[model samples]
Target chain A: MSEIELDLISHLSEYKRIFSFLTAEDIMKKELITLTPENYLSEARVIMRDKRISGIPIVDKEGKLVGLVSTERIIRALEEGIISNKIKEYMTPREKIVYFSPKDTFEKIVETFERYRYGRYPVIDEHNKLLGLITKHDILRAILKQFHSIYIHDRRREEYLNREVSILASDKFIEDKASFRYDINTQSISEAGEGTALLKKVLEKRGYHRDFIRRVSIGTYEAEVNVVIHAGGKGLILAFFEEDGVVVFVRDWGPGIEDIDLAMKEGFSTAPDHIRELGFGAGMGLPNMRRAADRLVILSQSGKGTRVEMVFNLKEGRD
Target chain B: MKLKEVMNTLEAKIYTGEELLEREISFGCASDMISDILALAKPGSLLLTGIIAPQIIRIAKILDLSGIVIVRGKEPMEETIAKAKEERVPLLGTKFLLFDACGKLYEKGLRGT
Candidate 1:
């Protein structure tokens, strides 16, 4: 292999080792709200809204994580006028899912998040039985908790205090980023990437690196595809350019995602066979968006709409 | 290998960018799925697909692909050809099936990305 490739592998393995000390069992949420495939989409939607959660794990009689239903599926069903349909018709089935075992280390989970960009992952046993759920926030909390102990032991209190002050002071200098908005017409799948293409051009004109532009385009394109395939084919794209990164907010007035947690799961798609035939609806759209963006947030209301926000942090000194 | 060699190996016909046949190509990938191409394809790799829409051409541009091969003797739409030309991406066609086309290229040492 080439030297650069070898260097990357070594760096990745070293990074993995640093976080391998903590496993999924250490940080996953043991308590979870779950449903069965026999449940109706309306029921799942109600549960997600009332519980203030974005997803629900669909379990079988054995409590296996057989499927998942989230707000994206709910919004899709609503758009199709099938809100009353069985959850089985809308849930992302188990075969396409990516799950983890309790023994999986934080490094593996972190790498998976970086690659898939899912909002949360289910921790299952060898038999595929649901155990707990883990999110990026949970991982952060665990890391922070670890740091607290390290700080207590190292006697680096003054240095830590000074670092925190510098971080807050740096935030004050970030000016209000310029914003741009565009109307997305999802009338045709062939035209789906246009909105993001425009964004790409704008970024390129500003002299951003091709790799950075590629990342933004991929994330924005996936968001655009979601709007087209699930959001009744009409939406809006809002972007803000920051000195260090870019923020994108994709909005749609169609049926909102009723359970976002399920929607964020990799391979959890609600698209029909027709859309699938076109090389889409593989349930990787959201994950792809997540993988490309440094951070992602989804907001939705059942009858109102859904808005997806993604932030991309650019590497310094590359441009 | 040059794209010209790939065309010769598959008995392909150029739909556009005949002047650019001398471009160097090192990798190949076949898929009808756009997401797969977006996620798996490497820069400058050649795409083998049966899809005939203008979207593929747009994707070719966005991903910086070397070119696209419309396999299975299928022809791309006029709009697709036009877009490929506008984007300066080579568009080619082959009478060989997708599998056979890929096999022929692989035999000639063209590897996948």
Candidate 2:
């Protein structure tokens, strides 16, 4: 097999082990847009169309989860001339559905996904109250986040990069040791990867191995985009090049993550609707960064800032 | 088998990149989940699915798929069509159901890689 293809097979299988370590609650969409069974069918239809959501939970007057109204049901209703009816008349009632608890892991969920072919499953607690929703897209995003842990930084890292750049540059008759940096504007997601893009091209041009370049690029891009989506303020990405790998430090000043433990969990995110809709937030960014690098260290102060240091070792398969 | 042969078997219409159908497909995959395809589809395979969204093109790009057959006669959004055209990924629509289209391709020598 070609080296790149064989490398992908090894990497993807390794990712399967890394990704199976989480439960449903860690990634479920907590801020829900729901419907009431008593509400007219038109309301659900409007919300689905407007929000680009395929399904919405139906709740009772007391906010207990009751059922779901999916696009399929709506289409069936439209064909049957039931659009004027209340959601209770056509929604898939709770008792007949396949739902998940907060404790179910992706290993468990993948079976359901493959067996049922449903687009999403609602997440509930012991009381059977709807806590949030988890979709195929969410699970996929979270899992694939691990799939590409290809890799990237810090003070020791800075020194290492300096040493490598100087040595590598000498071969080309250049003498300056330079560490790369980029300013990440929280509001400028469209431009978030400008730094990482150039960095990858430079490394590739410098004849780095394909696997090594991908690891550094993916890690740096994730860190850079995380700052743009979650940090709530301008941030900076600094890259260090070493002989064996790359290190990146994503430092941001903002309302820092309150719980580093919680933040490190896959599918954890506090990004608002604006960022989520723009496809920036799936709660996968940090865990992805963790897996991308061989060694990862996070430093943050609540109401202050966060600094994420990542190390990518070309020889190591995964941590 | 070539993507063009699969197209003729399913009686599908090329929505974008018609000139590219003569290219050979290394394999065939049937899935609506973009993430699964992105995570697992081998490069240069043919993807057959019922999903009609722009995300399909992105997944195709990530996997470097040979082409896509949107089964069940679903038309993608205009923007999705535009994206496929720009990305140079062949996108097609078939009147046959997803299972039937896949079966036809399988019968005509397309196997999952």
Best by lDDT: 1
Across residues A170-247, which tens digit of lDDT does each residue of candidate 1 receive? 123222443667789766887888888888889889988888888888888888888888888899887888887887
Cα deviation at A206, candidate 2, in Å, is 2.9
Candidate 2: CAPRI quality band = incorrect
Superposed model 2: Cα runs more than 4 Å off: A1-180, A186-194, A274-280, A316-319, B1-113
Q: CA shift at B39, candidate 1, in angstroms?
A: 0.9
Model 2, span A203-279: residue lDDT tens: 77888776566567666776776677677648977777777767677778977667776766666777777655444
Clashes of 2: 6
What is candidate 2's lDDT per residue for B19-82, written digit by digit as tens? 9978988989987643235334666888988777675675565456789888898887787689
Q: Which residue pairs overlap in candidate 1's backbone? A: A54-A259, A54-A260, A54-A261, A55-A262, A70-A259, A71-A257, A71-A258, A71-A259
lDDT of 1: 0.78
lDDT, candidate 1, B1-113, per-residue tens: 89999889989999899999999996898988777677777778999998888888877877778989999998888989998888899999999998999999999999995
